[model samples]
Structure formats: C-alpha cells, structure tokens
Target: MKILKFISVLAILVILVFSFWIYRSLNAPYSHNKNNQYIQIPQGSSPGQILVKLTSEGIISSPIPLKIYLKITGTGKEMQAGEYLFNSPITPLEVLSELKSGKLRTVKLTIPEGFTRFDIAKRITGQFPQNQAAGEDAVLKLTEDISLIKDIAPQAKNLEGYMYPNTYNFPRAVTTQAIIKQMVEEFKKVWKPEYADRASELKLKPHQIITIASLVETESRLDEERPVIASVIYNRLKKGMPLGIDQTAVYIAKMENRWDGVINKSDLESNSPYNTRKIIGLPPGPISSVSESSIKAALYPATTNYIYYVLNVDKEDKSHRFYSTAAEFERGKAAYQTWLKKERK
Candidate 1:
C-alpha cells in the first residue's frame, strides 16, 4: 500500500511539472537581436517549414512546443503565407495570432495627378530598390507594350497618359508589369463609355482626346480653366496654327533626355514633333498623365473664339487671361514678361 501511494504521488508531480513547462513555453517571449524583423512566408510553405524558419531566425526558441501548441489549438493548418513583420520578444501565442490575422506587409505608393509614365517609373524605382536591376530604362521599355491599353486606346503608341494616377498599396515582391497593369486597369475604370461617343462627336480618336487632355492638364491647375485651355487647343487645331504650348517644349526635352526644368531657346525651336511651338497639330503623344477633369474638358470645350492666353499676374492665383486679338495678346504678353523679369530679379 505504501509503494502504491508513493508511485501515484510521483506520477502526479511529474504531470504538474510537465503542464507548467508547456504553459511557460507557450507564453514565454522569444529572444531576438533586432527589435523588428521582416519574414517572408513563401507560398505553399508548410507549418513545419514555418516553425523551422521562425526558430532559425531567433523569433522563437523551440519549434517543437510551438508546433505542438499550434496542432492542439487547430491553428497549424490555418497559417497564411506572405510578408510578416515581427517585433522582438513576441510570444508564441501572439505570433500565431498575427499569422492568423492574414495581414501582409504592403508599401503605399502615391502617384499624384499629372505624373507622366516616366515619372511613375522613377517613383516605382525609388520605392522598390530591390528592383534596381530593372532601372528607368528597363521600366520605360516595359511601358512600350501597349497591349494593356489596346482595348481602350487601339491607336495608343504606349501607355503615356493612360496610367491612372492614384494611391496604391502593393506587396513587397510585386512585379513591375503587374504594377503597370494595375494602373492601366484603374484608368479603364475611370474612363466611361460615354467618353467614346463624345470622342466621335469631336471627330477625334480616344488617343487624340487623351493627348489634348494631357496638354490641358499641364497648362492649368484650375479645374474651371481646363475647358478654356481645351478651347484654345481646339481653336489652334481648327485654324491649322501651331499650338505653341510651352509644356510641349518641356515634353520634347524629356523625350530627348535633356530636360533640365528650364526651357532653352533651342527647346522651343526644336524640330521634334512633340514641340508644339514648331508643330502645327497635336503632339505625337501625351506630354503627361491627365486628370478626369482634364479629360472632360477635352471632350466638351467651352464656346470661345479666344486663341491666346497669358498668365494673369494681377491675381494671386496662377490664372490666365484670354485674348482674341493679336494686339491684345501682345499687350498681355508684354505685361507677363515684365512680371517675369521682376520675379526673377
């Protein structure tokens, strides 16, 4: 009887010790050198593989206990795969909870209004250094594939103005082509079917409308002025006169890879088709990404005979004054030059 009692007591004590160890292991914090670490749980990674990776990275002390805990709690099969950020000294339970939450790491990229495809490519490269192997040149090369925008803009040379500008959250390992596709898809969403009918009414193709919208976008920041700017462009086209838009000179400089923000005399006189000062019609392509308001203005221009516009120096807002006659335009031009010289001084 004494022997039996002693054996039962020893077994109970061993059970208590084992239970305490399991509890402590589950609740104990992991040891890590870094305060925060990013771990990529690759697709199709098994629970065992995840445990091994966590243990190897010093995110968890022992894999066995975590594996057992996960299995017992039915969370082992629920582990998701993606980029996960882990703070140091995280408990096993917390780690499991985080994994179960399915919150993948993402980078927020904001493409402001009027950003060109070239500008978008530069921003993407800056945001994702891991893609350094494919620099601006490589990205530009990818934009040349017009298949993504062919349905909406069959005549598009490339996705110049079709890359919709908006904020996007992308995964860390997303491909450049995928990002371009997403932007183009967003543009499609914003482009309504009615715009196509309006394009036909203006006797213009979708690409031409987008090109005009780009010109209007670069010329004015005011939404109300976009239609007026669009009217000026249309009037010039109708009269077979050169658009003479300074923004086109800037676009030419960019195309030749010589843009320095300051337009030289040569830029205005350049024989490039993109130079609106020298060319009689619309540019061969869009100069920049356009906004919805600009697109609307391009489709529906205001009824006006004014063919000239100069920056209105009298107003604090950067607005323009329209003139129908050459004499009035020259006067406005003189005032603008005077203001320009004074501002420079």
Candidate 2:
C-alpha cells in the first residue's frame, strides 16, 4: 500500500509540472516587428471567432489560454468595437484591455472653402450654442464681451468676416470664446509683412484690403480670375464711375431686412454713403472679409485699358468678357442675353 501511494504522488506532481509548462508556452507574449497594423474586430464577433482571427494573424498563439487569462483578469465583458492599431509585441490580455477602454481617435475638424462670416458664425454657434454659456448668442458672441477684440475690426460692425476659415482640432472641453480667439489669432498669424507692404503700395489700409478681398473671394471660385475683377474695380474708381456692384446694393438690402431677392432701381439709389452708386471710391468700409488671393488682387490689379466686362454666358463657363468700350460691352451683353434665354429654355 505504501509503494502504491508513493507512485501515485510522483505521477500527480509530474502532471502538474507539465500542465504549467503547456500554459506558459500557449500564452506567451506576441512579437510584431512589422509596421503598425490596424486590427478591426467586427461588431458582434464572438469570442471564438475573435480567437481564430487572432491566431491566424499571429496576434495570439491560442484562444483557450487567452480565455483562461481573461477569466482570471476580469476584463472579458468590457471589450469594445472600433479600428485599432497594434504598435508592438504585447500580450493578448493587454490588447483585449486596450480594446475594452475604447479610447477615441483624435482627428482634425476641417472647415470648407468659400464660407462667409455668417456661415462661420453659424458653424461655431452650432458647435457651442447659447445654452452652453449662460444665454449668450453663440461661441462668437462670447468674443464681443471681450473688450480687447471689440475694436479689432473697427470698420466691421460685427465679428462677421474676422472668423478665418480653416481646419481646427477642437477638443470636447474647449470653451466658447477661446475658439473665437483661436481663429482671430490664426488670421493674424497668416497676415504677413509682405501683405502690409502690398497694401501700402495699393494705397489701401489693411482693413480696406480685407473688405475688397472678401468681395473678390465671394465673386469667383477661380483663383486666377481675382486679379481681373480687381482691375475692373480699380478702372471704375479711376474713371469716377459708379462701381455698379449689385452685391453692394444687395448688402444694404440685407442689412435693412427689405431684400426682395434682387436689387431694384430704388435699392441702388438708397441714401447710405455705403451705396457705391451714390458715393464712389470703395464703400465706407469693406463689404466683407477678403481672402489671400483677393488681397493679392487688390494689391496687383491687371494692366488693361478695358473699362467694362460682362459674363461670357455664350460659353459654358461663367467667366466675363472684358471690353474697352461701351459698344463692345453692349455686344458682349447681347451675347450674354442670348445665352441666358437659351439656358432658361
């Protein structure tokens, strides 16, 4: 009986040692020296399916060992779904824990091109609204309360064009006014010394240049065409002619809350000094915030004796045809009319 008991004990000890060795071999840390790879666990993938995928991709050696480890570690129920990039050799337990944490992938928020001040304000406001800051109108409204920026653009009645459009990475916790200040600071940073020299050469104040640039920015989508439009404005200025910019009249109509979709004869004849038809030499201030290309256009206008331009409506493109005389302008206008009739048809 004693001999039998001793043999049984020895067999039990050997089995225990071998079991430990097997566990260690199966659950060893994974080594991935290649480029960091994205691992996607589809939503609703069972633990068994996940294990198979991990084993096939060399992310793990075995699923059974991982299951035991997870049961011991108490992190089995916390797994989340999303794209994840594994950077280096790590135990299966570590990767599982990381997926469970569900940390977000920080990304940049990009603002699209050709957005106006109202558009900018609406965008910012939508992100952080009045209720976010004690009944204030928007994130931009918080800027108005800051005394320092109130006088930033004296000519601009409100913070319309000052909010420069660009991509920004705003974390979830950022405050209302801080966002506005960031945009203003960004604009100032981009406004260079060369721009100031160019402004001086064109006999325009920085503020005035911004206004015209805003107009040019709104006028055309093509960067190449801004200089030509700038020349048209300058030619009109030299000839003591009314800018005849329907946009300006439309601006006034919008301000008065009486815009009837189009600028009628009476709208252009309004008594405001801002009415370019009544008083020439660029309105009292810039109508809107301008862009870099428009600023360049304002600085360097095209050299042309042409005094008039009408849309090349005959062509599929919306570009204008420049004319040196009223007769030529009339001919171009007639062609535009013919094209307009066909388009309507």
lDDT per model vs. reference: 0.88, 0.67
Task: Supply the TM-score for candidate 1.
Answer: 0.86
Output the lDDT of residue 319, model 2.
72
In candidate 2, where is summed lDDT lowest over 10 consecutive residues? 143-152
TM-score per candidate, in order?
A: 0.86, 0.63
Residue 289 lDDT in candidate 1:
85
Considering only N, C-alpha and C atoms within 3 Å, which residue pairs clash in candidate 2? Answer: 213-290, 214-289, 214-290
* lDDT (C-alpha) at residue 21 in model 2: 65
Best by lDDT: 1
lDDT (10s digit) by residue, model 2, range 7-48: 999999998987786567544677865327766667787666
- 1-345: candidate 1 lDDT, tens digit per residue: 999999999999998998788889889888687456678788899999999988887788888878878777877878888777887778887888877766678889898878887788889989977668778888888888999988878888889999888899998778888988898888888899999999999899999999999999999999999999999999989999999999888877877888888999999889988988877899888888888999999999999998999999999888999999899999999999999999999
